[model samples]
Target: GAGVSQSPRYKVAKRGQDVALRCDPISGHVSLFWYQQALGQGPEFLTYFQNEAQLDKSGLPSDRFFAERPEGSVSTLKIQRTQQEDSAVYLCASSGGHHSNQPQHFGDGTRLSIL
Candidate 1:
């Protein structure tokens, strides 16, 4: 019954620093995805995992961004050496499948602010 959740809801960091955001998806859901939403822009796919196996990560902008799901349940997104352009909302969603129209439930997201 637990829905997707992201921590901090907001994060502020100086350029060249690092930050980590957490996501907890609904219990029993096997599909999880991460997306980045810039101001006024649609959510862009960042990465996805199905039961601890990372199915895709082509959307990750740079090597500075990393994500992992060790136990097939919780996930973490870590951004290293943050830059001003990295400021955006980090969203997490979960669904019953890997399709684009699976009616994913979303967490509010952690809004990262790079200064």
Candidate 2:
């Protein structure tokens, strides 16, 4: 596929453990987004990146979450001190344009479970 790709299709973490999720967006994509989706709810934005710059991160639940796209390509999302409440599907998406109305391409999320 020519769209975004995410790794570790599934993850199980013990409470308090740290984990990292990876996302590889379509080549040349300029905008990237990370979202958290809980069961029975819609995906909630976690962060946004334009090229190599992190433009927004207000949606991140807490300081334990972090994301980066150092090379304006592959991105990584890290979560520390995982809690049961943190269990959710982490989604990654990318868009070819910078405009807010641009349609984003999404990757199958990494489902994380905290025990």
Candidate 3:
């Protein structure tokens, strides 16, 4: 199968607007993770899912951010009422399936800019 495919590549949004970012992990991958990465910083975990079950979301910055993996294949990260602080590269990573502790494959990510 192909490697992880992170989508949109870029986005520009005004403060207080909403945005949705999509990610496609490797085919048949059993786990997905979403993160926010600021310039010069490592990716910050926002949420995670195993199949269609959201197993952890404690890292999400605020209530305005949401993530889902419905049907267990594709994942989406949504931000409501975007803020200037939300400007960053949103990343998706996946690892697992009959295995654990495998290295996660990262995507190119969507660069989000909030004006």
Candidate 4:
């Protein structure tokens, strides 16, 4: 079975530019998550989805961040007006169940750099 997959692998954006990152979770997995990992910092949860429903987005830093999973399989994270502070690796993970203890599978992530 395939693990989570993210596109672009790397991106460079000038300050104030908008960037969209994409993720494809493993087939049939019901729990999906998005995270941001700044340099030297552990990944921080950005948003979560159960199937096609976005259940939690409180971790998003500000209104500039948005995420969606329209069909419960493919998801997207859009960052508007990118800033240098937004430079980091965006990670995507998926799990088989919604339970708190369910182990998650992670993707390599798309690294974004804002100049």
RMSD in Å for all candidates: 1.6, 0.9, 1.0, 1.0
10 residues in a row with least lDDT, candidate 4: 95-104
**Which of candidates 1 and 3 is the stronger one according to lDDT?**
1
**Residues 1-115, candidate 2, lDDT per residue (tens digit)?**
4878999999999999999999999998899999999999999999999999999999999999999999999999999999999999999999987778689889999999999
Deviation in angstroms for 94 in model 2?
0.3
Cα lDDT tens digits, model 1, 1-115, are: 5789899899999999999999999988889999999999999999999989999999999999999999999999999999999999999999875555577899999999999
Q: TM-scores across all candidates? A: 0.94, 0.96, 0.96, 0.95
Clash-forming residue pairs, model 4: none
lDDT (tens digit, per residue) of candidate 4 on 1-115: 4889999899999999999999999888899999999999999999999999999999999999999999888999999999999999999999997677578899999999999
Best by TM-score: 2
Flag clash pairs in model 2: none
RMSD of 3: 1.0
Question: Which candidate leads in lDDT?
Answer: 2
Clashing pairs in 3: none
lDDT of 2: 0.95
